[model samples]
Target: MTLGIDVVRAAPKVLLHDHLDGGLRPQTIAELAAGIGHELPVADPAGLGGWFAEAADSGSLERYLETFEHTVAVMQSAEALTRVARECVEDLAADGVVYAEIRYAPEQHVSAGLTLDEVVAAVQQGFDEASASGGIVVRQLLTAMRHQARSREIAELAVAWRDRGVAGFDIAGAEAGNPPTRHLDAFEYLQRENAHFTIHAGEAFGLPSIWQALQWCGADRLGHGVRIVDDITVHPDGTAELGRLAAYVRDKRIPLEMCPASNVQTGAADSIAEHPIGLLTRLGFRVTVNTDNRLMSNTSMSKEMHALCEAFDYGLADLRWFTINAMKSAFLPFDQRLALINDVIKPGYDKF
Candidate 1:
């Protein structure tokens, strides 16, 4: 039987595409804004959370991104970064996320007196302190703004800190005109160094964007690869046809970091009921659920799973499948991934 939302909430989860600045607690944001003498559209924490969700609900992708300006405004200092990072782990632990890879661009945080290295150090310290509570493994993905010209620097930063706590590199920001091919040099550098990287593609764009990321830049995973559904056509007789690109993605077993709610808000999908994650997951295309922006979407891992359960009739067993898929696709070493599966994820789900 499909259990209730309570069981879904209690299930151990893995998060792969959450953003650090976008996941801050509303109260933390308010406090940080005040401490920095910055202004917010809403001052009260509860009101501010609602405001973020409402603002992000705008149907335009460009308009949806504007909500980040406030969150990024308060995160320019080391103290603010550490506090947000620590609270991020604590909140994820409370929400039953046993493992997560939180990504943030270091370039966005250097406007204050801190250097790029100082920013990473502060966030790492926060994750370390929060992990002391146990039952949570948090890693970092140093992201570069794709619309900017610093991807090579960010990729090098990821490689330099691979032995420390940084797990991999990623390219984020708008995807309209800034195609992944623009950063081919950075991707090629990571390839030569044998480093891992995922590119944000096929979200606001279409299949050509995804092809460039995978075929041109060699991405390990597709961030918000929701638009790949464009290549799939469902017939009236309930049969489906897969385009060459979709077939290649499935045959290659490429992971799609699908964020359902965020897709709806950003106009990638019509709604959760009609979201492509259901089709992709059922088709065995290496689907993984994620919360792209917890604060903006007002979501958690449990919330995302519960929504999918209601949307797709997913049960405990089905939820376990998604959890394990995310774990397998994680950038963590094989030993670490298997240990988490054996000791944490499987046991946690088996109990339910």
Candidate 2:
């Protein structure tokens, strides 16, 4: 059941919770910044990448959140947005990702004079261009920052672009003070329209955050639900028992977009071996692996899968299980999900 990194990289994968702004190539960031006359703390591309990875490992919620300031600062125009979006697809496709849902906050990209719709169009243009020649299937998830009050605006955008390229909606940011309930109107509207949405909960906060996201906001999935690990109890005999919240999550089949490297970098866990995903996956909680921020975490879907396989001694079947879990939880239509799993993922992995 042991696997190598090369074999893992060659295996087909699915990613459900990657951030568009968080996955930019360092060289691309430098080029964009130079064109806009933006000053960067680290001008060299390799050094800049290392800076983000090192800076993100601060383990403090406030400090970790600050790393996005530079990345978002450079991505304020259509050219920067399109280039970042295009590179996101190319990078993931090179890492063997067959399907992915990339999320980004439109409200943050309005510094130079681009409207919310224009930002979406620019990113969509990049994805369409990538899809024309690549083998990867990429979709968009319109994200509204939880600290901001623009969820309704972003939610409506997702609904409007349902037929275009956007697949769903999400609200992400610091989860401690800004709970998902603050965006009740947006969640309510999405629910009424039967539109899909996920909430960022239980990453920096605890069970109360998760309770509000699901019980109050009606989230279809949990973004970084690592804190749900607090509800379960593990005994000396090696047996584990799920608390009420954990039981409900499992019973309802709610997908957990568990990001291993990002969680460790953000202090959600002490290490990957200590990550609750090991036990959560064993207990069957509809768990799926993710690269929360590719730049900050220095990770890819293939690397995430390889890390888990090394940590858990997983093989081809375990990798397949996680890939299928993500594919099932994709916001893409059921027929399309089925086609990718049956036609692409299965056949691709069959070679090894």
Candidate 3:
């Protein structure tokens, strides 16, 4: 027998690909907006969040990115950054997320005359405080905007803060026209320094975008690689065919940070029922469930797992596979990872 949605909600989870800016409390956004005298799309929390989700539905990646203006606007100060980061961890902890890696662009917070280091320090401080209070382990991923030409500086910032709370580097924003390869210099520097980086590819775009990120830029993971399914085919006889890129990705065991609800909202998949998570899981691909943006998608790790369970009939064992896969793909030290597996993950699964 296997536990269902009620049990899954209590199960501990590991989260990757969650953005700090994208996960702010709707109430916090409104409060911050008021403090800064910035006008929001909606005055109320529920309506404000709906506006973000609606604006992000634009098929074009550039258009989808326009919604970030509101999030980034309120995050211009260190105090705001710290408060939001702390609350984000608290919220996840209450929702049963044990470990999480949150990413944000440092450059986006400098409008308040704060240096990049100040921004990183503020968010790290927030994570530290939240961890103390909530007992949740949180790490940071510093991101560089692909359209911006300052990736090298952002990479350096990530490396500088790695000893603190920063865990890795990532490229975000408008992944269609601006591929990860455009930031080759930053990727080369990170590679030379042995830093881990994941790229946003194959989400709103297709396979060519994924190929460029992995083949040219050497990404450690694929952020929203949902569109990599394009490289796969199935014959009338029920035999699956894998194209070269798909085969390479599968063989390499590169993690796919799949955000099911976000994928549907962005048209990456037709619906959660038809999502390739079920297909890829059966094929042994390293698939991890994530809530790309809790506010924008109105989701959490629990909701994502519940959705998968209902959509694919996943049970306790299947949920265990997702958790272990996420732990394996997490950018944590070997000892800590094993400890989490043995101490936290296994015990939670047993209870379910």
Highest lDDT model number: 1
How well does candidate 2 match the true structure in TM-score terms? 0.98
TM-score of 1: 0.98
The better candidate by lDDT, 1 or 3, is 1
Clashing pairs in model 3, backbone N/Cα/C closer than 3 A:
none
Candidate 2 vs candidate 3: the TM-score winner is 2
Error of 1 at 28 (Å): 0.7
Question: Which stretches of model 3 miss by more than 4 angstroms?
Answer: 1-4, 57-64
Candidate 1 per-residue lDDT over residues 1-352, each given as its tens digit: 4467778879999999999988999999899999989899899999999989998997765656778999999999888899999999999999999999999999999987788889999999999999986999999999999889999999999998888899999999789889989998999999999988999999989999999999999999999999898999988987789999999999998999999988888888888989999989878899999999999998998988899888888888888998899999999999999999999999998896
Better-scoring candidate (lDDT), 1 or 2: 1
Candidate 1 regions with alpha-carbon error over 4 angstroms = none
Q: Count clashing residue pairs in model 3.
A: 0
The weakest ten consecutive residues by lDDT in model 1 span 58-67
lDDT of 3 by residue, 27-133 (tens): 89999999999898789988888877777775665656666788889999989999999999999998888889999989999998999999999999899999996
Overall local distance difference test of candidate 2: 0.90
Taken over the whole model, the C-alpha lDDT of each candidate is 0.91, 0.90, 0.89
